[model samples]
Target: MLIMNRKRMVEDKLDRLTKGQTAYAESRELIRLVKREIQNRQIPVLMDETDSGCWFIPQKNTTTPSDEQLAQM
Candidate 1:
């Protein structure tokens, strides 16, 4: 439940970031919170910055499947 709440908070902040409705200064704390949560949870995602604001993005998976695995798929 706590994890879910944290996830929701991160999502809300990301939404505001994407909408470009909040000032960067105001969103700084929110960005910090999101970053802390990401680190604490070991989430497989990253935060990226843009001219307008910042947003979350899925991290690229580093592992590659072997030939047998690919064939099974």
Candidate 2:
């Protein structure tokens, strides 16, 4: 299939690119760049799952009312 061929081509090119570099260094750099790109793309499902814990804070605690505390008046 066309998709399979393209995947093969990309794999080939990546293999060629890393062939000259040391295995450990090349693999570490490749992993870092791939993770950076994935983060930059900001995929919704990935973003939600990655941030599910920290981004969800209680709505009432998000804002403080200075007027209620007699500070704004």
Best by TM-score: 1
Candidate 2, residues 19-60, lDDT tens digits: the string is 432111123333444334434643221111232221111111
- Candidate 1 TM-score to native: 0.51
lDDT of each: 0.59, 0.32
Residue 2 in model 2: shift from native, Å? 24
Winning candidate number (lDDT): 1
TM-score of each: 0.51, 0.25
Off by over 4 Å in 2: 1-26, 44-73
How big is the RMSD of model 1? 8.6
Model 1 alpha-carbon miss at residue 15, Å? 12
User: Total clashes, candidate 1?
Assistant: 0
Residues 1-73, model 1: lDDT tens digits: 3334645667775555445433231256566777776577565665666655566664545899999999999
